[model samples]
Target: MVMRWWSDRWTQSAGAFFLEKDAIFFASARDFLAGVLAAVVITCWNLAAVERNAIVQASQKPYQTLSSRYLYKTHKAKSGRNIHDASFRVYRSSPAMAELLLFEDIFTITGIDTDGKKFDKVSRIEARSEQFDMQLVLDVNIDVYPIARTDKFTLALSSTLRLDGTPDDGVFDQSRKKSLADKYEYVMYGKLYKYDDDESGGAIKIGVYVSFGGLLMMLKGDKQHLGNLKLDQRLYLLMRKV
Candidate 1:
């Protein structure tokens, strides 16, 4: 009987403690529910904030509302371009860079057309650099398109960087002034089908496609020779200097 009485007292005491804390527990529950509702509302609102017209609309806003508008301004429909297109980069070279190509002996390679037009040096060789010109070694390459194909021929080849007065890679580490033409394995492409002048001496036709390889070197020749390089770890071809 005593044990049963003590058990009833313990149960009553536990109930009283729960009643006392009920107010605080209910307040906490309300707070937790409000927090959950606020978080869901915020997430939904944020998702709606992102839109496809974001760039165009955002670009029109003031600096206070959208500080990043200036960068995306060009993305507008009328602009139709990107900011990166405006600027570019290139490497530095030595004053005497390196003579990458040198024709020690260029002989009497002459020809005449049937049209009564006399030509002196007729054997034309095509190299990799778009700016390469044996007559004026400076334009050997540029940042423009090197490979081209017209009604005549499709030319393609490469050359190694000539490291002489400067480093081969054209980095601005050491400043040396000189044209550096390093040794290059000159390559040329020729076609099998040949071209010959008419009996009346018309235009002379050339081969369809042929390949040639020779030892040509590059030194620190000129800095402005190649307009811009494609950036290395690639096969660069140079032409033989006749």
Candidate 2:
């Protein structure tokens, strides 16, 4: 009878121990599941917030889609090979240049053909920014769109002429619907080939180079002015004498 009594006590103790252990295990599992659920909720909320912000930005400026700024100073192009070949070769030394390639977009002509004519129809123009003090070396088709020294012009760079900021279709659009091009006098389409940063001057300087069917352009300035540009982007250069 004593042995049986002892057996009953031990069985009760073992049962209590196992019940307590099971309760602990279930409680931990429940806490882990709750943490995972909370994390998922937070992640979803963050993604929704980002989407809302993007929508707001897109709607804020529906008509003004191009990246633009004003430029006022100018300089002459250095005499050398064709502007296209010269700019390409300079950046081609970098592997990124081989892989790929605007404006608040205004500039004033400072110097024109300071060296000499590189091409009969194309004249290299040196220009400067009125606001940012950026420098530009551009080749214009003089026979088609004549630009002279001391000319004040607004230049805009855009991926698409559409005011709605759509991606370019890569086909020449004959549609006469008013576009960003309609507001400009001269326009050229090109692809950005290279982007580089130079720190030799103590301050960082950025260089952006593009080619419009061999008509070349180089823009150099601080990061604030060129930060929006991306490599290998197709761009439209729009200009109007302001």
Candidate 3:
């Protein structure tokens, strides 16, 4: 069942709008929501420290065009002129296929065909200012695979990601700039999952092993050791589609 209710919106738009952030609640009691809500997540958007008010400020800027007002502004800026914007639109949809616009400050596209083939690519992204401007023209490639119970376990790899840039906020870059790179990246591999349902509470279990190398390494250069990291994969007891 679906329900609609009214609440206060902090923005000056000054009208009631539908709340699209749905929650999937699992219930242990029969009186409440007895099962988990099937809120599927095909995409995700991650924003930094910016708040709801910052987007409102950006929306009112003179740069906003007449035709772009309907797009959803998902990203936010913390200080000065740094800002980001994104929008997701369904470009095409059919009985068993779909194409979606992946908007995460940057823009990209993903298409899933009826025959289970998928294509993902990232194109041009623009960010400009009065003093400096940079445009990301790199193309992104994505690959996916569906694994079943019998799939064998694989090795893990670890690596680092480095970010380097200096701000122009009245500070001089005297060649001694600091980097925003990753200290270390950790990785783990899980092969088996075990679930039990009896009078004792239902439980799900999985077997996992870790490695500091291979595709699991997400750290930058070996400047320092920030200690071992933990995995961040969600768990679910998946029942095979018979």
Q: Using Cα atoms with residue i matched to residue i, what is each candidate's TM-score against the true structure? A: 0.22, 0.57, 0.14
What's the count of clashing pairs in each model shown?
A: 63, 21, 15
Clash count (model 3, backbone only): 15
lDDT of 3 by residue, 105-147 (tens): 1112122232333334312111211111111111112221232
lDDT of 1 at 54: 73
C-alpha lDDT of candidate 3 relative to the true structure: 0.23
lDDT (tens digit, per residue) of candidate 1 on 151-192: 111122323334432224423224444222212112332211
| Model 2 per-residue lDDT at 197 | 92
- Per-model CA lDDT versus the true structure: 0.31, 0.70, 0.23
Give the winner by TM-score.
Answer: 2
Ranking the candidates on lDDT from highest down gives 2, 1, 3
- Superposed on all Cα atoms, model 2 deviates from the true structure by an RMSD in Å of 19.6
Q: Single out the weakest 10-residue window by summed lDDT for candidate 2.
A: 83-92
* Regions more than 4 Å wrong, model 3: 1-56, 59-69, 79-108, 112-138, 141-242
